[model samples]
Target: MRKSNLIFIFLMLIIATSCDNEEAVSEQSSTEFSSMQDGLITLKSGAIVEKKGDDFYYQSDMLLSQKQLETLNEHGDFIIEEPDQIENETEIHPVYNIPVEANEDGPAVPRAFGLYPTPYNMWAMVRFVYAPNLTADRKNIIQQALQHWEANTNVRFYNATGQPTVDPVYGFEYPYIEFVNATGNSSAVGRIGGRQKIRIAAWQATSVAIHEIGHAIGLRHEQSRYDRDNSININLSNVHPDNRHNFNKYTSNYFAVGSIDYNSVMMYDSDAFAINPAIPVMTKKSDGSTWNGGNVLSNPDRSWANNIYIPYIARSDTYRELAPVVYKPDNTVMTPSERLALQAQLNNGNPNPPNCCRLPNNF
Candidate 1:
């Protein structure tokens, strides 16, 4: 075997040996809520989401649709060498809309995925285990990748002795990840309420595992954000026809956080979707540079996480709508006076300002 492979094996054995006595921290959700109920919206990937108090969820878990969350998202992975490795291709993360009755923090301030920061508290404790077929090297790679997330954020992940068939008495809901055999690296974003899978191909396991975990923690690809066009120029003409849809920006739901972060862990490398090897699909505008993607969490990556999972504020009986993630055609939000003016404008188009209550010409 090559020296690098041998050194890797040694490292793997060390990690595995160190984990020999690794105890599983058993737990359950700290927050209290009514029984799980059906949500009003259905996503393109068929994940069902609803609002329980101020938070949104997929059944019992708070998950949003990747397509719809574009209004909010603007945020995975696959094949090692293939150019088609993109979130829409290998994995689909969800994003929930602002609650009909929003929260005090408003819908936009905090809470998105079940990663470093979860709503139950400030940190999402993830308990995970390995598939029987998983080799030691793969295990080492996966655990180390998880450590990167742990080191960077407030979130934490555990290596379970076995699959969590039930909730941890002291931890969050089935907060477990199980490694499985798969073609490419992919992880369902957020907790799916059970044994979530982080599929990794052994060949390029480390980086891919980190990328998938980034998705698991509720982040979308940087290039997929609503404001991505402002920074990177996606060369759709040079992109493969089958992979073109990956370039579409948000139309259904949310807005970008502040600006486009070119070096996010969630962003794609420049040559990722090229039709030909030499044809780059994404290019930067500032200096005509190409997005190569961050091998580790960039400043924006950490800041976005800090912003999404700041502190958990329980849902109140009386909802407080902070800022609207989506705006009505009248360009009005929850302020009382704005609503009254909107009524007048919609009723007879009376006294409408140039900017306010102006629907598009088509509308």
Candidate 2:
């Protein structure tokens, strides 16, 4: 079967948000929630998602949609490829609002079919809004995290606060992220469609916001790498059974870039999901000692973001040419001369650029 869009491995859980209501889901411990009335949704492709209330979830926090679940039911095999191989024959130039037809079935993040392959899902330029109910403190934390990403990677976040969620001229609903307050932190693995949330709690640190944004932008927990066994050994015995799935290694279907990163903000600490907080549930294979995962974006994290995204300036006009001022993935701004050179390469120096463009202030 054709592979779906690329990237991510899984962490975090989001409570189902209704179409009209943005109320946060009650903060319930994952262990307790797992023991609550829940149903396991097993797909024909052998993918499993947990159904609690009206939402479906994979691993801990990556939300799964019914359409994505249906796609999984139709196709099964997904091969993990290197980062360079992500732009294979099937891959297209990352563009805004372009439709991509592919099956989204498999693990979350990093060179896999699991990511929503549609251009709208690819986050050409990350656009976000702060929920009105969000407090100033949480907003400040989010801003700090945003600064960290901008400083380290090519990922750019446009603050769409006080902006309309729809395009006034074209009447298309714009895809955008909304930062909302919740009891516990959770976010959809990648862009799942319109208005996905990055739920933050009062107790979370700026580092936590950074991590959730990683998920929102399509980076999964570092431990979910299928080859994680080579780097760290999981002590399933010490883990709570309901939360054990959080530590489950991804299959070959999910791809990764570079070796396992202990310092990646995406990684879980050694005691993550541990039944006894003081007991270690994971340890480095080489040393047999637990490690505290890092809060900053590691080198691999920066490389991954740089590889997958290109910064663009949102515009209202239907100008398809690369923006005159674009940001490279290495946190460097491209010169106008360089932008024109790349634009020439992309459009064959066509005077008339494509007509479809990311609309300004849309979502």
Candidate 3:
């Protein structure tokens, strides 16, 4: 039997320059990979990545920061067996966790592989700033994407445009995301600490912004799950040589939350990286069907976010305030009474705890 595309792969970079012009550029043609050249580097974990220009990449779209490279270098352990299980109604969300290092924040809890962990890497509320140079269209795309996430999941974003990067009163730097214009779309997987960029191209849609934000909040490509061969098959020969690495699967270290979700915004479309524009690079194993990559959060996608993130009012106060809207793990809004009860549970039996500062109006 020819070897399946069940391969373990990592960082692969594609370099392009950022453009500040207000006009939206036309989308890259289907043969966009034809002119690409990439550089490769191997990390401490034996995962090889592509280094292009000044940035390192994982799976071509996820930008890797120096700190993220270090974290991957330090730990390479797995907690679960290979997930041969398929998606069922009761599917459990599988996430990656590393042994915690001693730090002021408690030991890292089990989180999605490359997730921003609590009290440190994790955001109290995901803060963001629009790049001053971003065109109006790009900014609007970002705003639409942000609204989608807030509507479906417990994750909330604070508009910190024109705000200082540091807490003016406390003198501590804030971890935030900046939406910038680039020739291609990409974002760091999870929070890479301090300030990170989510690069959106002029021609990309709001869905692309949604996808990159999913990465910034710690989700990997659904198709990259280790056991995805059971759900879909890759036509390796049909893929571009440089882009074949994009179809590589995650090993045991990266866990799957549920069965392969065809609707996952993190999934690549049927023709992604295809050598022939009309031929599919991915097809369903069950029926040989081709599916489009998701444009919005699916049920499993919302469930994954709700499982990991807590909605909070962004503030510099000693006391943490749960946002008025909280989503249950089932992606349902909690009843007012239930929300109050949970609020009390989070705040030491005080449903209406005193907040240190005024809550921002944006939330």
In candidate 3, what are the lDDT values of residues 1-363, reduced to their tens digit? 111100100000000011111222224521232133558655567665677766667788888765454444444311122333322312223322322132333332222222322223334467899888998888888888998998899887888888899878776566779999999899987655567899999967889999999988878888777668978989989986667768766664343443588888888899998889688989999999999978998876786777566676766554446778888655778788877766665555678857467556452
- lDDT for each residue of candidate 1 in 1-363, tens digit (9 for 90 to 100): 234323322432232222111123223221222233534433334333444343343322223322223222211111011222222221111112121223343433221222322232112345577888987767777877876765555344555655455645745445457777665566656554445677776676466777777666666566766556767777888876545655655322222334566566666789986778687888887787776777777655664453332111112221211112212211222255544443333224343323333211110
* lDDT values for all models: 0.46, 0.61, 0.65
* Candidate 3 error regions (>4 Å): 1-38, 42-46, 70-121, 167-172, 252-255, 353-356, 361-363
Error of 1 at 211 (Å): 0.8
Question: How do all the candidates rank in terms of TM-score, highest first?
Answer: 3, 2, 1
Report model 1's TM-score to 2 decimal places.
Answer: 0.52
Better of 1 and 2 by lDDT: 2
Candidate 3 CA-lDDT value: 0.65
lDDT of 1: 0.46
Residue-by-residue lDDT tens digits, candidate 2, 294-313 = 78887657755754655445
| Pairs clashing within candidate 3 | 11-50, 93-257, 94-257
TM-score per candidate: 0.52, 0.69, 0.75
| Model 3 error, position 17 (Å) | 37
